[model samples]
Target chain A: MNSEILNIPLNDYKTTVESLKNEGFEMMMDLTVVDWFRKKEPRFEIVVQFLSTSHNKRKTLKTFVNDEDLSISSITDIYPSANFYEREAFDMFGIIFENHPDLTRILMPDDWVGHPLRKNYGSGRIPVQFKNAPKVD
Target chain B: MKDYKVKKSKLSNFKNKLDFWATNSEEGGWNISSTDEGSQKMLENENEEQIKIQTGTEVLDDFVIDEETSDDERMIVNMGPQHPSTHGVLRLQAELEGEVVRRVKPIIGYLHTGMEKTGEELNYFQGPTNTTRMDYLSPLFNELVFSLTTEKLIGIEVPERAKTIRILMTELNRISSHLVALATGGMDIGALSMMIFGFRERELILNFFEKTTGLRMNHNFIRPGGVAADLPDGWQKDVQEILKVIPEKLQDYDDMLLDNPIWKGRLQNVGILTTEECFAYGITGPSLRASGYSWDLRKSQPYSGIEKFDFEIPVLNEGDVFARWRVKVLEIFESLKIVEQSMHNMPKGPYKIQDKKITPPPRKRLDESMEALIHHFKIYTEGFKVPEGDAYVAIESPRGELGCYIVSDGSSKPYRMHVRGPSFCNLQALPVIMTDSPIADAVAAIASLDPVIGDVDR
Candidate 1:
């Protein structure tokens, strides 16, 4: 019910987050990217949730990232915990987080080919071959 | 390149060392630079030896010392991806200078099945089944958060009985989860009897769960509208039995390990995480509380009528492995208290909401009424639709604050569904806790954190 969402432009993103940190939103609770693909322009939306323990308040921040330019400023400097969350967002959505300490894959294997969570990516499975079993054509 | 040995110092000097370690630990302890030929050659030689050992070609050397390496030399060691203490498939690449752990990087994802991606494929009604598997230990908490998010998006209030049932089951789940944490934590610290006692008590709660939910682990009992079914007959008797027995067992555990010197030595003052570090690292729940930050989602956020129940959030200023362990033990008593309160104050009513769009018609109603029959047929076939919006709901899971974020585009299936697993966030604090500690204490630190790999890699 505490739907206090702040939609900020790309330019003001870092400054807004820095101010939020200064304003006592000490914890960056969750960071994730929502890919819209053909449904909406600026194909990706970065959603972040911040919690201020002192005030018991939660704020949700939303920012858009275009598919052509998938890079965004990382908030890891403000919240060291954003390190893994940023890596996960990068791993799943292929959105580049500029200045992230280690922006490599966190959940997926390093050799994995594509970002699996992207809407454009197919959710296909590999066929299992059973040894010494008859195959049905 | 300089000598890295920390000298024995006074209390104030040790505090300074802790502060220095806190800042420098983030750089990661055991990094091998590509340009550093000596360390890189040592690494390659170690790998070659590993290959030889695997192929049964190398002789086992228990105490072979190389003259090339100095006394203060640091070497990289892999604790697991297989080691019993690393919990499950968690590979920790530690930088060790003798028995001391200089740095640790927890490499996970071996158990990753992409549950978040799987959640998108499932509709709102079937969402719990996917989320429930994320935190296997507290499966109900996962389901509860997912259902809470869905219910938030739909703007529907469940019945009082349903809310009470959710509280009752989740509190019981918290006890079972903490019991496993205690068991594993005790086992890691060499308190084998404590492990057995912990599991023995846990079996009683698990039996109650098995009787009610019909599954031991991933019970998708908590749904969007409400719970799957009503509590079975004689449920109160089972509840009473758990309440009567666990307190005595807890007393026995206290008698066994409370003042034991070995237990204190292994856990106390090891893996000290202060409140500032907890906030910066986004640590929550008992780990944060153990650091003296008195915040619990159950107390502060209060979901599913949880605030109606009376319970205290245990806090300790030490923030060491002992404090984390002690916080969890104290939390079990608090959860038991909540369970008892919910059982006594439970109101009789419908299990789920009576909305025709959400809850399906009863079996008896389906036989009598054509409208009810149509409703039942439609509900299961396509599931219910949610309004166009996004909502994030957080609840105090045993691990920490487990949150679910759902984005809906006016459809039965969520456009995007993401679970903020506490284990995933809590794993980031590993370097801070494990760095500069002894190898054995590293195990204790990890055990105290109590991260479920399923939850972390999900």
Candidate 2:
């Protein structure tokens, strides 16, 4: 199947990315951090998705990071496009990248407290209006 | 300050840093910059300690770049959290040398709804609701990709009729999205007449969407198993009307914008990028196509029976503002052609999966069959479960390749769902292409890029 998952070790994440780039994964399709808080041993999984336009295939490299140590090698060197994705990972999961060019939050505010995407973070919701049709009664 | 960072990498071979400084030009067309190596400068130097306080989300780092330089000929200008040209709340911080732009950093996330994280709380069936909102212009593509990924994981084929409906609706959506792109590009550049004409056709297509799905935007019609409902009666007539009207309108646009001297002057050779730069920066869809690469997901990676349709993928080699404008305009005709074919080959049968576990029983069945009543109740209340696995599906949206990655854990709710929004990835090409252009062309570049900030931020 074109859609397949490959487990990438936390330590070997950079090498895996480097090898994939050599094998013609032209672009990093999407890079996201999945927080499987209660289900998995490592609290975070840095999911890196790559697309090889030459071969017409998709490969997903997932590296696990525990809650205590949230860090991974940045793939910006392999793909300059990883600039924003890596920063987004840091913003949401607190997964510090080793060598990102600019590891600033891409989607969240500068002063926003805590990684809101973390499983433990509050709902990030506020019940303001239109709850069960306005209370005309 | 950025010109001096030397933390070495294999791909770090470039001259003159792409840094940011706020511009105070009363007219605010472009900017100017230089350094005499000593005296007071109007462009205030960012206080190192103050950048630490104002740094949004990056960890503060120490002195790396030489603060004072021999050349003080650069000025940074912020594009928009509110500027009309920028489609939405996209802020481009550019470092300029007089009229030429040296660097552009796109600061986004003003419209972030955090929908990806929230998708985990919703089950497989409820996924479309969250995803459809991601790419607000091409909402159906968002729903279609999410549904396709989940369907791949669950290992089920949607009924042929549903697949056909999806193709038809999304193709129509593609036309409307591109219309918005054309309109905004026209309004951003100096083609004011193109703006009014573009919205007129878009309004007609939106009426079709309202008929098929209840809502005008964010229609969660495409479900995991199939579409939420079958095509409404007389949808064929509406589809035919759209197909007939768009081609004629496109011909009119060709007259107004295509060969017009002013349009050519503003767009031609502006914001040029080679095919390698397009590939390197992960730009897809029209932007990549404009660079003369025919790497469309619909053609290369066929989905929802797009392979069966007969259409030509437009390719433009110029890779500039005018080339992208031409590329999108041509693709609209191609999309209209797909809608025509879909209407001709419309399948007749159930519009959703027949499996009771995945799809609810029909309304009439609820009256006669007890099992149907129970199944309908359970399906709506709890939703269907997807087997433990992940699927990544990419399809061509108007802006670029819109992809979605869904991970399920054999539970009702998803483990993770991520949308690789085309605008988000395509916007990366901005800094790469904008580093050496005039400021006016940079606006044209941003407009030609057609970044819907909702999609970019989401």
Candidate 3:
């Protein structure tokens, strides 16, 4: 019942994850990126949701990462459930998962270039083949 | 460009050699030089090949059509991309050693439809249309979770009657969704009769839903601020009829499957999920409850006037596939009780919030007042904006703790929306469940988890 929401900053993501692992937060429900294209500097926000059965509590950790090299510590070592979700985040938002064992695409094909979930991604473009049909004048 | 032209000449020479071989073969005897139209057509085909070679810029698309099966010690077995027992388009590449599974990597997204990204592009009012498509079996649950989160962020006070009606519809949806799992799970385990019986009762429930929401599967009845419209006339009567029949049918299902030795043997102790492991995977709903953790969102944190309903959160001590099945069957009865109570205590008032900002003004008033017309147009076109904040709402859906986390930046569309789908969490236990079990049991284990690929891939 003693639950509190902690707003940890982006730099402390690794340390916070390590500490939570020590505290028996064993499950990583999801890790997703929210693209705030309208923002400056860090245009992408990473959200990690965790649950601790011993404490019967769930907490969401949010952090901002720069668009230049959007990477974060992969939590696969701590929570095996994150294996698919992190791959999905990578496939959709183009956020890289540092040290992920198999960081290949989960939702899209291996040859897909641009992430489709990014706000600026062009719509109606062919996904798998990436073939651009000639535009009519 | 000069190098490409040289390669094109060599490619033409190769094509000429292939044509010569084809013509010389007994099965493919054709005249190389003849005046017949068929021979002329063959010449024209060769001319087109010459044109392709003359272009000299065509890139030979090098694609690996079929990957050469590796001779490494790893054994590759495809669980399903199309197999019926997979529940949906879920393909798992499991690395096995003899009879033991070494590692399993699930390949999803065959059912992906860009639902989350689509939600961001659409207006807030159109959000339900996208959310309902994620978990098609439990559309009302998806819409309700999204609507509640958006409503909480927007600070709109939905009418008491609207909240009651929402609860009523969602509880019925919970039963309907569980029935789908039960029927399909039963069929997956070789009990074909159970599927027929389960669907028989489920059709009655879907009939009630169609009466109220005007749709059988994807009922977008629950919307932001409240329900889409008031319940149709005699809605209570129709719901009461279902309550009267469903409990008896559920009893018959229990009698048929609960004590059958074959069904019990296949599920009672198979795919056992320990309490510690269930918590570690953040498992919820029947799967969590079957492991002896009595956590139901309806009792822990009631929303949409669910606290007023009289129902029990069904739980079991056995953390196996059978236990999960039992928990769901018991929940059907519990839902029926809630539906009967809601029907008896049905409230009378407007079904949606009266605020012109959220709900449009009445159609009659639109003709009379210019202000009403403008408000209606604005509400429909632009949609109401939510405050810049985030809220996570969890509901005890038939599938488990179905939660929606919404982040709004004071815009008509959600800045970010994520679903804590029970199927996705429950499916995490599959690798552990199938590690030592026979390969056939893997299919039953997956079906018992009742994963909808739409939810998983999204």
Question: Residue by residue across B1-458, what tens digits does model 2's lDDT show?
Answer: 35445545322432112221233222222223332221212123433322222221211111123355335777777777789998888888887776676556778888988887788888887889898888899999999999888888888898889989999999999999999999989999978888999999999999989988999999999998899998889888888899889999999999887778988988887777677666667888898889888888898889988899999999999888889999999999899889999999998999999898898888999999999898999998899888897778888888888888887888899887888888887787777666656787878988988998888887
Q: Of the candidates numbered 2 and 3, which has the greater DockQ value?
A: 3
RMSD of 2: 13.0
Could you give me the TM-score of model 2 versus the true structure? 0.85
A-chain TM-score of every model: 0.90, 0.86, 0.82
Give residue B325's error in model 3 in angstroms: 1.2
The regions of model 2 sitting more than 4 angstroms off are A125-137, B1-73, B368-370
- Please give, for residues B86-145, the per-residue lDDT of candidate 3 as tens digits: 888887767555554544546666777777777777778988988888888889999999
Ranking by DockQ: 1, 3, 2
Total clashing residue pairs per candidate?
0, 10, 1
Candidate 2 clash pair list: A110-B56, B33-B72, B33-B73, B33-B74, B34-B71, B34-B72, B34-B73, B34-B74, B35-B71, B35-B72
Choose the strongest candidate by DockQ. Answer: 1
**What share of the reference contacts survives in each candidate?**
0.55, 0.52, 0.35
Measured with C-alpha atoms, the lDDT of residue A20 in candidate 3 is 88
Which pairs of residues have clashing backbones in candidate 3?
A: B285-B400
DockQ scores of all models, one per candidate: 0.38, 0.31, 0.36
